[model samples]
Target: MGLGVERFTTQLPEHLHCFVCLDVSYPPVIVCALEHQMCESCATELRKSSSKGKCPMCAQTMLDPVRTSGVLKRAIEDYEVTCRYTGCKWVGCLLDEPTHAKSCDFREIPCALCKTPYQHSRSVQHMLVCPEEVVLCPQGGKRCARKKRCELEKHLSDFCGQWQCRVVQGCDTRTSLANLPAHEKTCADAAARIAKLEEALSGRNETLATILTELRAKLDSLDPTRHASPPRFDWPAGQPAERTVSTCTLVKQLLTRATKRRHRRATLAATALLAKPLPSPHVAVLQESAPASPPAPALA
Candidate 1:
């Protein structure tokens, strides 16, 4: 009395498959005048294969393919498809299949140069600095290998034996690449000479500093009135003669004091020089080489 009817089905419609490729049609699906749909990629291949550009199913003349309708596009998107890649069991909506394929770890991609298979996304980056890829040494072929591109620079800088010293002014010593630091530390002759020169310079500096201090002190003592301004006198006209005479006497006293201070300074300097023992033979030679003072000119 009753025939069983299956209510629900998740199967994709046959019209949604490309007629030429016999695979699920992806957007933008091309439609013939009879409304027969084909995937865009298959439609292009079919056109290229056929000089007359005929539709595979209807044998009708093919024209430029138009964009698929939104309702059909949505229906295709809702349909689920299993991953085409072998060993991958992922199942998702038709719209997201391409994205999943792009990021899928199990997808195989061939290397650009070596043609070795690798994971899909990492293939391009692996090619860039690949160890198997040959590259020349950066140091103009100084006993360096045409090693891997990633290791070429490191080989020249850190492992090449022909590298020269980096020190600019001193020590032209050239050594092996790894021995540069060790050679710089024990570079004997130049280092010893530099040390001796530095010691001599320090001694000269000390002697100069002592002489400068003595000279400064002597100058200070000699010119007591150096910073003192001359006395300003506002003498009114018709002043007493005795007041004028007193002013002149005061000025004479100041000049006499300045002259005495100068003589005293010269005496003290000479005495100090005589009292100091010469610390080095160089000082005795300097004293002997100094010029004699000329006799004072006769007063006219």
Candidate 2:
């Protein structure tokens, strides 16, 4: 009763309790010269009842005014206290017990919004479903209006659908900004998807490079004497130095091969270019292509 705890008596040891009232001796524990300890209320009442300052325990003439026991007060303050709230599982010192009680999640507190008292631990559940509660969109920024928590999902889809991600370099982060604990899956994880696409394109690039190297080598072998003389094409009447049919055939073959590979290359390029994340409706992705290496000085 002294501490105003619901189950205060259940945790205190018998030795710490007042001898008269059998309650935990809180601060201001009055002590007689013989060191008999009782609550301040009990000491005051006993003094009023007796003609002389009489010891309650031994029936002896006691000191005129019993002094407050500083030693006992300090000792009791260090005592371990278990929270009085059932199922709270908060164990702390007697000094911190009062403070913890005020902020304990198990304790019922009035909501600032609805003004209805509910257990603070279940605040998320209550806030989401409480008819009186109103919440703002988390991703909608300043544009979205406050809506009932129950109807927030529809509002997010309809109202916050156009909310663009302001992620630095867009897809550079390792995790999605929207993917938080108990948060809705709103935006795509751009980083992870881009990583996968880069992986797939990596092997394809090596293959394309090998093909280019082989073609270049073949072209170099065909024009073995390219350095000696500049090969001349079939010109109008009185043109000098006639070129071979083999050179023309080689050029045709190379063009045919390039045309065939161009479609394949374009298909792969298109696939990479259209990297659409499943969750995102509109994408503002950008990529810079490296300048194409000058085709190995073509020999005509």
Candidate 3:
């Protein structure tokens, strides 16, 4: 009710009590005498209710009906008092009561961002997910400056273009989309592209190596000298052999020359296809020359 009279170390004078409410009168109104004062709230109510133009305590005619006593208000505020909120142990001069009420832990206050009421003690917890609170864009926050916490997911996928690019070959750099014109020049994505290119080239080389091996095998199979040995015939008992081994030998010689020419051409084509140097370490280098074919068997 009135600033607690019990809180003060020394008892206040009897004149300080309002004649109407019988409580310690704050903002005491001086109606007639200094000894007969009423609380401003009581005086104003009585003025409107009853037109008795007389001071209730001393039966004296009311003169100007003045309602405020600055001296009494100051006297009341000078005394120390404890906080009114239940369980709050804070004690201070009455003048500071309004300031302390705003920050008391047990009191409820509205969030500045969302305007939702919550306990002052929970301010830190409330701010963590407050929809209106501004926060970094979470997906590489360094790029985009700010976003509302409620919009974090939308900002990640739709709004913010900057992202943590894929790391490649132990490079831990990140590049932004804002500087996309120079994207290839930046080492971050450049390293990633290089890694992808190497993978593709490695597979191509493996395929090329297989093709070259197949071509080499086909060329060796076509060697005429490999079939140069003459087949033995079942001779008639009385007749001389119509065809001599020398005749078969001459035919084989012509075939060997023609086969050699084709082998040389196939080898040259393979070499041309593999002319460029392979950069990937995973693929073995293709040599310029194939291993020499075993010397052509002597033509019969």
Candidate 4:
């Protein structure tokens, strides 16, 4: 036909050996020991026996690269891979290698249902329907559907629990250290006592007025003239008893009796004036009268 197809063939076809059995035509590319290679699973198994990381076939350090053909590498890039495990069922592109490794078919995640560690592919499906994955009501001693824990606590405290039974009765002020126990015992008692005292003081105002009136009356009842005794006359001394004393004594006695009568009348008048509640003018009169003492008796 056109010159035989074989004429166009080059070494590219010849080097296409399965890196594994070297039996197949195509080999997948993989990385191992910092080198590019094919058949990674076989290389990994081979690593167990040799701590040196030597290649199984060549006994060379597995650090040696077994580069896959550029053409095969490009072909693998176009294909998608899926895990073969039954429930696992993760599927993604070969080009997404790093991403797949991070969240991959073989990766592990804890199960929501059983809490058992299972493959990520299966765990994702299990979590969707898992009973344990359901967030519970935190207020009632379980995780709540409400997003905020604080809100849940408020709801339970206000609406759900026996909060009414826990109602606080009195004001909640912190008493000073010196007054705490005394405040507790007599807080209400002290308030009541203060109120009673205030009421007594306010209501007894008329009684107080009456008492003041009585005190003023008693003070007014005092006799102004009673402040001093009646003046007394002295009998004359060193005189002859018969010649000087007889007529003088008789006259002195009469004058004394007359003076006593005048004094009694003055006292009666002052007592009556004071009893009538004299104003400031009577006080001046009383003071003026008080200074007049009787003249000293003539020597007999």
Candidate 5:
């Protein structure tokens, strides 16, 4: 009548069905002495009932419960089964039953936090207020209200109202995400002032460098070794007067020799003048009167 009954009837072959349970063997099929196949649950029940662990079908004493052959194992895995949960119509391989059970909408599972049973599809919604779940704090948990772990990063970065400015220096202002832009503008002004101060300091360094260069040049000019000549001896002012007197005597001797040479030249000039005879006025008059007697003397 139900889907599960119909699926079991159609999908599971009669040969693979457990002899005791009369259903398809899920896994761990047990083999008795007569090779009669049964589910492990039925085999375990039979062993407990009889003191000697006798097989129900053969009446033989069961020593060790052997597993079903490979052919039976494969056949059991390939058989299709309908979901056991009420109102679920899912039908697939027996091997895939566990996977379908985990996600089945009608199946109930215990919540990780509240420990209350919730349908698998509604488990996520119920976890929001589960008492056992631990969460993080908003505002990066640095100093803000606690929040769910899943929503912490988003709340801190996008929605927290108590977030502080990240500027570590020159400003210790605290502001919310809504006023962060205004605080950043203030920080920008402070940064600009610092840059101006640094530029002025650099200019002052350049001026100091120029002044140092000028001073170095002046010092080099004042160094005496740059214009030095050969050394000469200088007499002291307190030396003996005898050296000065000897210098004056040598000068007077040179002047006396010069005066004697001049007198000798004047004396030679006077002697040459006195050696010539002088013509008297009376002799000049007699030569003029005897001029006519000269012609008669030349004829004799």
Candidate 6:
């Protein structure tokens, strides 16, 4: 009854399902909108409706049925299927045209070194390490564009000899690759930094020694003077003597005081040495040699 129907029917084989209204004998074209048929009437109604007119049969909006072009429909029905590569999960129809090609990730790029197929990202990375991808010298030099690694080394040394050093904050001096090892060996800034470190260590050691010496001297100056001895007791005749004693007890107390002071000084010096960057060994030895009590005179 219509060209749209003819276009649709011509593409399909002799027997296939068609929309119920568009059959050749009863081409009455059942209405989805006023005087419209082929079930597309509902789509026209929905398109014109204020709130999107729905299908009269199901009361669902009919404006957006999926439409397939003739080419696409035939391709899907007749397409033979095979996966492009082993282990691919896809098992169904692959169109011969560029429909699937738009999304396919298997496209190839030529290797810059050898015009062989390689993936684009992988080929770029390979070029970074590939010797054959070497750039030719614009100057008419006898060396081939892809010079052997050994010959390239020699050529670069003789010609573009200024190789960058590996050091961070590197030396600015330019030298041939052959001479880089020697130049780095005697780099003056590196040597100066080492000298400064050595000097700082030496100065710290001297300061520690001086502090320890002064501490020992202070410990030695503790009082060694004698305290008052107990006075002799006078005795009455034939009576047991009532013995009187001076403050010998105080002398013992003084000795105790001196011992504690010596101990405190030794402890302080030990702590000071521990606080130093490098401790002097003599501080430990000196602390061990401290007298347990002051001299005999002080004790008495």
Scanning candidate 2 in windows of ten residues, the lowest lDDT window is: 173-182
Return whichever of 4 and 5 wins on lDDT.
5
lDDT of 2 by residue, 14-115 (tens): 666777777777654555666787777777777777446677787776656777788777767786777866669988777888899998978888888778
Instruction: List lDDT for all candidates, in order.
Output: 0.69, 0.67, 0.72, 0.53, 0.69, 0.50
lDDT for each residue of candidate 4 in 1-300, tens digit (9 for 90 to 100): 111112111223333334554422234433454444545445555556445566544555665454555776565445455533334355554455446566566666677455667677566666655545543344343422432333444455444432221122454544333454455566667667878999999879979999999987787678566457788655445545545568867688768878999999999999998889556887898997897788999999
Q: Give the higher-lDDT candidate: 4 or 6.
A: 4
Better structure of 3 and 6 per lDDT: 3
What are the clashing pairs of model 6?
Answer: 230-246
Per-model TM-score versus the true fold: 0.34, 0.31, 0.34, 0.23, 0.36, 0.29
Return the TM-score for candidate 4, rounded to 2 decimals: 0.23
lDDT of 6 by residue, 1-300 (tens): 222323221343322222433332112233343322233333444457775655545555443542323443443334344434323334443344245443444445566556666544355665655555555432224333545333465567566545555452456766666777777767856867988999999999999999999987776677434344677644323533344423575457557878999999999999998888965679978888977876567554
Worst 10 residues of 6 by lDDT: 1-10
TM-score of 3: 0.34
- State the lDDT of candidate 5 residue by residue for 2-83, as single tens digits: 1233555365656766666775554545556567767677667777774567777787776485565667777776767788
Give me the runs in candidate 6 sitting further than 4 Å from their true place: 1-82, 85-90, 94-103, 111-114, 120-159, 164-170, 188-204, 207-300
TM match of model 5 to true structure: 0.36
What number of clashing residue pairs does each candidate have, in the order they appear?
0, 0, 0, 10, 0, 1
* RMSD (CA, Å), each prediction: 23.6, 31.3, 27.1, 29.7, 30.8, 29.4
lDDT string, candidate 1, 143-204, tens digits: 56678776776777777665555554555566666787777666655677888999999999
CA error at residue 157 for candidate 5, angstroms = 44
Best by lDDT: 3
Better of 3 and 6 by TM-score: 3
